[model samples]
Target: MEGFRLWPGALDAEAQSQLVQAVFGALGTAPLYRPQTPGGRPFSVQMSNLGPLGWVSDRGGYRYQPTHPVTGQAWPAIPQMLLDLWAATVGGKRAPDACLVNLYRDGAKMGLHQDRDEADLTAPVLSISLGDAAQFRIADGEGRTRTLRLTSGDVCALTGSARLARHGIDRVLEGSSRLIPGGGRLNLTLRIAR
Candidate 1:
């Protein structure tokens, strides 16, 4: 919690709508696909990426690549709005190299884990939430955990001491918002992978 920053409703409703459209547009090129764990178990959430690198998981292991796993095409560029958001929130000479996009629906949840695959752990990870709300959980150094309800337009970041902390979504609150045409939550995480 020492280095976690939360800007409630960072993006107003209109901005949220525009960002959603941009995300969908990018996904049109690199469609979302359910990823598998290294053990071959399927992940509950559908995932895709934007920027120079995309995070991927398969039988081989978790790593970053330049192309989509299913389409075999290069990922679309990171949305300009997100680039601006990163600049305003976590100012640095280098912008994030990856924006991992995740769609959660039907009780999809992610287990608590540290984001350590990136080469630079010092850079903060910025997360933008949209659609239905989610019970976001993160652990502190004392082994205690804190949970927050992340709704559409809400943005949070794990920086400094909290950058590599264990965090995840415990569950998504269904029917909370009507942003995503169908019912689901979209989480876009910006990270400096390399």
Candidate 2:
């Protein structure tokens, strides 16, 4: 956790609710879709985006694009709340041009991987959690790993030495929070695609 900053309960109940609503609005424009790895295996979590660029994966590979794969339309603008959060937390640095919205439900979980698709590796990745809590695992290249309980409204940033660290959600604690209408977890990751 040396290079990571965790702000537990960064958003209050009302703020969380508003953010969720904003997510719903974004979803309306670019619906969430299950992404496939370069190997053609589907990811457990479904994803969408809110920004000029969106992170996506398929048989082609993992990269960022300017439009939705399904609708072929540009992603909705990043939510103001998210922009404010990034400014207050990771500001004084380059602003993010992409916001990857990941939805996890039931047994959905992500595997350990590094976020290296961005052009600017030095920029921090700001992640915000909503709905259920998740067991987030982070590890260095040496394989030293640690798990953190990321509850609803938790905000965390991976910067400095941890910017390229391997990280993923081990599992979501179901029914941990009712912030999400259908019982699931939402993770918003802000990054600089270019």
Candidate 3:
């Protein structure tokens, strides 16, 4: 929790299941899109964002904004369970205005990067992993490094020194669980992007 660790079932089973359903239900409204990197190469993982702000990347760069880049529509509201988990994990703190949902299909992996796009680095990032498991890598602000295997219903909070540290998923294991039909991983990261 302080440096880096996993919090399993941070959300109860009922809340977790409903959260997943809420997300997938909205997937049709604002479908996932694979944005190209700044260099014009498309990222391997397709993603979508919810809440007041959504995370996006393309030929321009990586950043957060109020409206969806494609439809110019406000992002879907952040599910109550997500906000509740953040509240339980970091109590009394204002809820994050942005929730970036990363959908990782088999063989899709995110590269290492620091989450500097937000206005305040002190705001802890609340991430939930559903459907399948993935290896999450974290490097310290200095020289320390560690690896964590995040499974379904697992949650992680990035705060204090780790808030600005570099992290990413190594890859999602295919056919790892029956939670999601295609054996994919759904990672919802909550952040105060404003």
**Could you estimate the TM-score for every candidate?**
0.98, 0.98, 0.93
Rank order (by TM-score, best first): 1, 2, 3
Which is the winner by lDDT between candidate 2 and candidate 3?
Answer: 2
Flag regions of model 3 displaced more than 4 Å: none
Q: What lDDT score goes with residue 173 in model 2? A: 95
- lDDT string for model 2 (9-94, tens) is 89999999999999988899899999899999999999999999999999999899999999999999998888999999878567
For candidate 3, the per-residue lDDT at 154 reads: 88
Predicted candidate 3, C-alpha RMSD: 1.6
Clashing pairs in 1: none
Every candidate's lDDT: 0.95, 0.93, 0.82
Question: Which lDDT value does model 1 have at 123?
Answer: 90
**RMSD (CA, angstroms), candidate 2:** 0.8
User: Per-residue lDDT of 1-194 in model 3, one digit per residue for the tens?
Assistant: 35554687766667667888999887766788888888999878878888888888887799998777777788889888777778878655588999888888858999888888998887788889988889998888675667888888888888786788888888788778777646689899899987
Residue 152 in candidate 1, Cα distance off native in Å: 0.7
